[model samples]
Target: MSKKTLLSEIKEKIDQLVNAGFNNPTQIAKRIHRDLSIDETERTINHTRGTVKYHIHQSKKRKSNPALAQACQERGINFDNVGIAWNKDKHWSIQFRPSETGPTFEEMLQDHIDAIKNHNFKYEKIRRQNYSLPCLLVIDPADIHVGKLASSFETGEDYNTQIAVQRVKEGVDGILQKASGFNIEKIVFVAGNDILHIDTPKRVTTSGTPQDTDGMWYDNFLIAKRLYVDILDKLVKIADVHVMYNPSNHDYTNGFFLADAIKSWYRTCKNISFDVSIAHRKYFKYGTSLIGTTHGDGAKQQDLPLLMAQESKKMWSDTKHRYVYIHHIHHKVSKDYHGVTVEALRSPSSADSWHHRNGYQHSPKAIEGFVHSKDNGQIARFTHLF
Candidate 1:
């Protein structure tokens, strides 16, 4: 065999050894060195201990990611930011950031489309509402934190995924009953103000802060999804609905993905529209009103007015009344800037252990809604406190 062929054979043998539970680099090297020394033909390779160590490393890497190595070889591009975590079962978990030339944007987008299609969400068409009133209903179930856990013994309040879902349904029902007096033409459902307590299966937020969680990450996600779908179904019957997603810090990435999935779920519903992008702040225009929604973890309260004006310039200019609803403080604070009103809405989620220990349990739990007129600005505000 050629030298290249011999080297490939040696690598395959080392990989086989690795798969057979020979994970100790030093022991594997000694075994290979001894085997090669004993075999006269394989002795052509005078593999020193250092050479055996190199081969062992290469074998482990290849075992961890054979397809990735082959792809890199074919594309002539190396992957950076490689990481390996050793398992107790003598296996390695490999992770790496995608290479610069890994997948084109179109390819990634197509993959996402295929994934969405694979979900096979049952799509039902929503009938168009013919309400002739020029009024808008804004329902914001803020800071639900679906997976958060709080015990009555520790935090003086019991909160869990079940409580979180029940509160949203109850709050929305209350808001709808109160707003029954108004002639509504449109409904804006503000979503994703830390709707999830944890972003990862490790029971932590997106930024890696450990959390007091009540349920599994995926279970809570499904619970929140069902809650939103149920609420949107009700809202669409009353008026055309606009779902605005406010990306938050706790479940930032997961929240965006959930929002995207919701949008896909209602893709065929003509009465529902979606703003599910990853933008931290989202703006919606209603008649003479310009409303902004944000998670309130980013940017200073004082700066939101100018930021709103800059971000939604056309809406700011066209509307006579402007409001920015923010969450994450869990308390209520409303202030009118020079031309904009910034309101930090209250949350219905009870305090978890951290918040209760930190003395942040004073704020009353509530879900808020606002009613706006086409000619006038915000005419009514409703708070359903739990």
Candidate 2:
């Protein structure tokens, strides 16, 4: 058998010491000196700790990564069983592994980004005359949860992508019907109150937590964007549409993607505007009312009214009525504080098995909307029950 290289032997000793719990650099250096008789400088060891660990992790990962394993095999070495030890003596001993594995998720995402920039995908929004109305209609498709599956056998209700889509459409129609007598000039459509049931392709939230979902994440994403675009397109004919994105706990990353997709869809349209900023608290001024929207999953309820006032002081001073809209609780609750009304909007989503089993059963299945007048602030509230 060929004798082990000096760097390999050093790396092996370090790994043994590390596995034996010699974590601190001082401790590791002492152990190396004792075991291998190598005068490894303490400061050098300290600096090298991160690199060593990273290489060790990479080595472990390479085993599971078929291409990496195959490349190491071709080199008469196993990257899985041995970590790469870099020093002044050698650099880039190995780069990519050779195998027939497909492109990574990151590679696919980058390709998609490149495609967007090159206009391989077409996006266009209509620009219409600024037909202002006396009142601004606000809808909270809040907690829409587009790809959630709930069987009546479990939750006493049946829900899926189709039901979620239909409910939002019907609820908005109901709100329009109720406001038929009012002259509305603009609409504010707040997206991303858990608009997606999960954030990842693996049916999980942004934090890598799993969720019960109705369909694949891509399917859900398309379904969500389709619903938002459909509703906004319908409303644009009657009034100018102001779109706001409020990222939530469930789909932080993908929700932003969905929001941006909607913005891109209406990018060129004059009748539609967007607040696609990834702000936790977004403020919009319509007529005499100053309105703020958030996901409600973060921050204390009491702090929000004050936050709204402090964050949008100029708007607060200019408007007679101040209100904050919140979602995530999936039910309506209102509180008045220091001249502001902070209210949580209701959602039309039926309870999934988790919610049903947990006794989160009393929330009314409905969607809510608000009417803000040019001078009087919120004049009416519309609720469409499931």
Candidate 3:
């Protein structure tokens, strides 16, 4: 056989041994002789050991004298090719096999670095466009049961109405700050249902009669309304405002009332639009996208997409991009469903703990937030805005 052909045959044999987990030199040499039908007398097993030891020693030597060992360990390294050294202190190392299966370590690392830089450039380019323009901050502040109490896991600190409100304020502030950085066209607010405590009268529950002051329901509604209005009024300074309201089952009777009151108040405010329609319906539209808000009470968890699609088809048949933002389960599920993207939002409520005892414990600890870009025809994109 020609020298080149013989060398190629030897390399293939070595690869087969490596893949079979026969790393020991003696066993590999014996297997090679058997497979190739070489004369056992002419082919000494010691020569095979020598070849394996030479390759291993070369790899170790590359760590110190890389210039001399590079040609033996790497491909395309003629005397004229440029040379590079190995970094021994790195946590991970990559070794090339004779099979030529994947890129060398240095090449892979360089590609990864270049990819990161490209991604960063794209993000910066997006940020530069529409710089300092007013942004339309769309937020779903759902299930903020003001009178609910949280356990140790929910809050490191003890649970109280005061603590819940404070925690929610932090989330609201984070969303506001993120939205402020973008060029906001308008701010759309969707207050999800279960905003207040509608526990049965004092004699019923195990928590020794839940607190319900005379104006507790009304006062809680006022508190949530005032907080929401104050935040929106501040955001409106940078952009126009639009509000969407959806009622939940827990407080559907009273929650709808509170939602109506806020909508009525917004009608009086200048430069702000309010849409207080029925629960579980498409209540807002932005460009080619139509948003449907629901408290997630009527349908099963797995049936959300079907429910939203059916609702969208009925409400606005010409809607290009359909989105359903629901709160109640307090878990975040973002995925494409039957050509539409469905999202189950996480809540800023302490009452989510009650769900755990009932065997539903996938809710997110941190509140969920999202930023929708009208520039792209996308329906919804979720983020932990807080």
What is residue 260's positional error in candidate 1, in angstroms? 0.4
lDDT of each residue in 1-386, candidate 1, tens digit only: 56676556666667777779875444555566565443545552325333544565454465557666676678775533344322233475555532222223343344346445545555466565465666899999999999999999998889999999999999999999999998888899999989999887678999999999986676677688878888987888788899999999899987887898789878887779999988888999888999999999999999998999999999899998999999999999999899899999999999888988888886889999999998788999999989
Give the winner by lDDT. 1
**Which of the two candidates, 1 or 3, achieves a greater lDDT against the reference?**
1
Candidate 3 C-alpha lDDT tens digits along 7-40: 4566578767777776555566667777777665
Better of 1 and 3 by TM-score: 1
Clashing pairs in 1: none
TM-score of each: 0.69, 0.69, 0.55
**What clash count goes with each model?**
0, 5, 10
2 against 3, candidate with superior TM-score: 2
lDDT of 2 by residue, 1-386 (tens): 12245456657776787678754434454555566554455334433443454445454466466554675678898564543432232554444333222334453354335324534333244454554557889988789898888998878889999999999999999988988778877889888889998877667788887777886676577678778878987888777888888999999988888788777766667778899888899999987899999999998889998898889989988998989999999887899998889999888888888888899976888988899998889999999998
| True lDDT of residue 29, candidate 2 | 49
After superposing all C-alphas onto the true structure, candidate 3 shows an RMSD in angstroms of 26.1
